[model samples]
Target: MAQTTAKYHCLVTGFGPFYRYTEEENPAWLAVKPLTNSIIEDEQNNVRPIHVSTLQLPVSYQAVMDVVPLLHSHPPVFHPSIAEQAARNGVARPQKGYDFILHVGVAGRGALRVERVAHKFGYNMKDIYGRQAPVVETAPLPVEPEEPGDVPEEVLHISAPQIEQNQLELAEGPEPTPEPIRPKRGFGPGYENFQEEVYSDVNVVSLIRNMKQQNFEDVYLSMDAGHYLPDFIYYCSLAEVIRSVKPYERRRGTQVLVVHVPPVGQPLTSEQVTTALKLIITWVCSELQSIDDTLAKERFQ
Candidate 1:
């Protein structure tokens, strides 16, 4: 069997509006500096450099074009466009060629609570758009598979007809050769389960899709005014992309890229940055070690 070989290079794009975060000295393009500039190391002193890049695009459809070329899976024959250049260097004309593209930005979910924050109470529960959201359904209790003596009920799959119709209507595009840059997952030694907090936030993109009829650029610019996404949502999106590459190895892949986003126009505290950096390191190291472990099990067999 031939092993896959393609260099993994990540292009991390952050937002640079008219201004930067308050704690920063320079006109910073990114909100979270920890995510952009970093070095990954091991006990043996082997190091892999992580490269970061930022973009300054007006929150518009043009921003979406900046990353689309990078997503080509194959020959990577870039259809050169001026927008690509503007995306990469804020002015350079974008030319064909790039391995992978990643972008992170902030959203204005807090604005939803701002008006309420001024009131006597903490804040109202409506989203940024002022619509009161209903109580979200929690995860249902997992029902274990039937025991050996138990009779299994007939399987019932609730499929969507519209989805099926869409599938039929969907057309295949040019296939790009898959170059996987799977990122590692899980926490590293020490700082495990650090300051975990659960909060409810809507995927504003979904709302935009409903309102604008699936215009991501409109939604992105409107919600992500400063262009930073919530960290967890960015992580989830990153994981989804990786899993799409090799669904079987979803739990056991290295090179997991987590795009750490921050609130608009602010730098995270040192402690917060430290925790994020530590978790990323742990994931990379664990994934590297587990390659042999997964190989021994021969699940790929």
Candidate 2:
């Protein structure tokens, strides 16, 4: 008898509009909306289709808390109030738990950043409602910041031209542009000062490599998922994954990743961003299939 392959499911999330960017649409949602219910075919002929389930999360910190727990649960439940149509359509819960949970948000400026690590701590910056996260908290695991030098030249160059163009526009403005904000070396006061980082469970390096191989542009690995809503969601989701498992037992949990996109009116269009997203999703499903096949062989051996 021929063997049947397992279907892979992904939960892609994007943030809704916030008060700060009232006039402009959040690019995350704009990019993600096109992908919901989309079926991506594997480059290899034999693999089954990869199903994408997308969600538009509210900008509230409270919503992050409420929604993430549901995702972490076994056979995740979708409350009717969240989005009745989406819930009924299987967007809320996958028949088999999600293989990947990708959170997308706007990074204000920069190229398409495939974030490497999400810190447990949040900064003094407020959310959409002017609410702030606690200054410090115990990280689920320790993490070190990646050196800027380690970033690939190809990735760095992705946003160079656009950034330069923006600088020129700001230079010609009525008021002088302020100096660009540089990354801080150490954690600010109140925390132990150690780098408390949790990396994305997804194979970001391989993911980016695949994108480059396929001729995709402007995609880079980012070390910082700044202390804002994106970082909060990434950290919280990762924490839930870890918490779901037994303390000291090794198990393959859901693969979690946060992708930061540039703000609207940037050089890249919605189509370009959406294409990049589809490519990443395809790559992730392919990687997960390979892993599953390897594990199956090991079990039978």
Clashing pairs in 2: 143-197
lDDT per residue (tens digit) for residues 91-124 in model 1: 2122322223334444322211100000111112
* Candidate 2 positional error at 232, Å: 0.5
**Number of clashes recorded per candidate:** 22, 1
Cα RMSD to the true fold for all candidates: 20.3, 13.6
Stretch of 10 with least lDDT, candidate 1: 112-121
Q: How accurate locally, in lDDT, is each candidate?
A: 0.33, 0.75
Give the number of the best model, judged by TM-score. Answer: 2
What does candidate 1 score on TM?
Answer: 0.34
Residue 276 in model 1: lDDT: 40
